[model samples]
Target: MVPITRTVPAPSSVRTARAPRRVTRPAIPGVVLAVIGLGAMAVVSLWWRDTPVIHGFGAMLTGAGQVLGLLSGYGFVVLVALMARLPPLERGIGADRLARWHAMGGRYVISLVTGHVLAITWGYAVTAHESVTSEAVTLLTSYPDVLMATVAWFLLLGIAAFSARAARRRLAYETWYYAHLYTYLAIALAFSHQFADGASFAGNLAARVAWSSLYALIGGLIAWYRLVTPLLMFARHRFTVAGVRPEAPGIVSVYITGRDLDALGAEPGQFFRWRFLARSLAWQSHPYSLSAMPRPDMMRITVKARGDHSGSLSSLRPGTRVIAEGPYGAFTPALSGRRVLLVAGGVGITPIRAMFAALPRRMSEGITLIYRASNPRDIVFRQELDAIAADRGAVVHYVVGSRARLGYDPLSALYLRAMVPGLHRYEAYVCGPAGMTRAVVAALRASGLRRRRIHHETFDF
Candidate 1:
């Protein structure tokens, strides 16, 4: 840990003129996805409307059930596509937002499917003049594919129950991740029923082809990006742990060496889900942001001992085999705006450090880092930060104190406004623990920075 120190005063000669904005690649707007989703729902509703029999209570109930079923199918395919790790969405919308979208979309699927079950069963019972319970059991046992679909319904409900915030917080990341994989199985079973007896597709060849094509495209994306691409990269790169070094107490940096790693195309501030083939470690993979720019043959990821998995990183020996699944994240220079302001709390500094190294700058007056930690001992890479600051003419401000202590305030809006001159003129990059991120984001917004200019990355489930 480095000692608490005041930031270097802004160079008097530093111009007050606002830094010009960096031209960014035009991102495919997120609303494009929203519009498509709405359009698919409308298509289903239109299909229901075109039906010959349009009136009775039982008929209407069945019709509504069919619409809900169609929407759930749309939800299944789109949700899977979002998680397929496509490069376009990964680079444009980013991992954090993508995960959030998937979660919200999952909620919609739950509602749609739940409605489908109730409405379909109720309608059949009314038409047959049987009890709802008997109708449900009859459908499950008698209908082709319905029994499998019933299994899928229960699987989906179980997933939804565990995905609730309270339940998810108690589960291990590995456990939660593996449980989610069952979603693929659930969708497969559900899709089979759609073809066997789906009201919308009955006697409709065009509908069958369109829906099948959608699923086939999604399958190809998953097979290529999730399975085949990773295997090819593994064979080509042959990544292996070169060494692990402690940067601070309970924090270690792992150096990975591989063949032709330059071809990986990983940028600073990006992360990879690393699966190390070692004792007690081969069971799961974890995301760690790159702590340094990747070289042709090697790369580095810094980890803090936050849990059993992360704490055990220091125990990994050199020469361990590694499989990495990303280069994922949008927290890079591609999102840069005007001037750069890097805000790092605890180990969140990992990505900030890498970005600092790669930031092309003749003068760093416009670049500043606000490194926050509870105390000096919690700070990592203090020496390297100073070296980079000295070489790049940037300033590093270590805000060290416990937030719970009285008269121990740092990282306040006032403090930030003073530390980074022309506060509203910079494009701020913030990475930290959840609490700190929320606080810093609020502070940045209070100080007049636009939401668009403050880019951050998070994987907090």
Candidate 2:
């Protein structure tokens, strides 16, 4: 494709001035942390109230187990809340950050559950003058809800094992995702056991009421954001595929036409978790960034053939029904500086391309885009980017070559400083493969940009 380099006047919308939206980064995270801390305190208070005396080793072990179990139950609630896809948390803390927190928290919670089981079993064994194995068997067979809790524990362990980094590599995305859905079932099975057997909850009406309320709140959030909102969007907008246009060898842009799209409140750099109502495609939803600015009746998303779901999008028929979960993410130009820099790698250019067109150019020093691709053929949206650059009086640099061919990294700190004079004054946005994103972020920091000035989101879960 021939590159369009001739300068043309920018559209009136592009030329118009709009003040950037200010977001206080620490405010939401601080509130979330404070709430979690409050929950922890409440869990400990239950144990304090119930445990008035502990005179023996067995009693001490059992008391510790009780506290651990209560905290673990509370942790599960927090874990679900993090992944509930609430708009405030998603936009404030970011989806990638929330996923990282959930993964880390899962590990800790699993460890707590294991500790709770061991301590409780050992304590019971000592108190009854019985073998540990005998005590465990009795607990499972005779206790009111111990059997179900044991099953839940095993299910949780299985999920954690599959979620490990090594196991994730061997598993398909769909397989791993579906396996995680069982977590809700496990939590449900464990709930009755917590109430029936937990020392902290036994005869403690206030504790039981508070614990139940926490679970109810998280469940409501998930139902509204993850379920009801999408159904509402489908009913209101009625999104459907309009066409599929191949961009490069393996990338295609899917056009979606919808009614009252502007009411969806989709911004330039946000993405949607789209579930296409087609054979083999309706079961899974994948997040795709908007590849262009949304029109009143249409939007576009560019997909690269990475796996089964993405590979099938190019063959999607026109008029295919779609259910989109969001216009989510906080990667927009809202918090950017007057002098802005966008760096995109391979298929990561989708959101960057949209931001390039929509970012107001008036009262700005300059806007620069650095697109990195393995080869010329790997570059997507070349012609459109060149046209936008020409029209907006922005700079577009296509850094196309393999690392071996180039002999050195073009996005290194020294090179970045040379390419964009006064780089310290610019706010940078980066999206790419994990390695490339990390490298570019390091380069930006080394080039004197502060951490807050560099914004990024990775698709790596």
Q: How accurate is candidate 2 locally (lDDT)?
A: 0.85
* Per-residue lDDT over 1-461 for candidate 1, one digit per residue giving the tens place of the 0 to 100 score: 32212221221112211212243756554664866668687757656665668568777788888888888888898889888999877767778888888999999988999999899999888888999999999998899999998899999999998888999999987788899999999999898899897877888888889899989999999999887877788888998888777778888888888898767777778888888989899878788998876666677888998887899988888789998888888787653543689999889999888877666564364878899888787788777778777766888899888878637457778889989878998888899988888888888999999998888875585
Q: Runs in model 1 with CA error above 4 Å?
A: 1-23, 29-32, 335-338, 406-409
Give per-residue CA lDDT, model 2, range 413-437, as digits (tens).
9989988899899989898999999
Model 2 is weakest, by summed lDDT over 10 consecutive residues, at 3-12
Error of 1 at 28 (Å): 2.8
Q: For candidate 2, what is the TM-score?
A: 0.94
RMSD to truth, every model: 5.6, 3.4
- The lDDT of model 1 is 0.80
Q: How does candidate 1 fare on TM-score?
A: 0.91
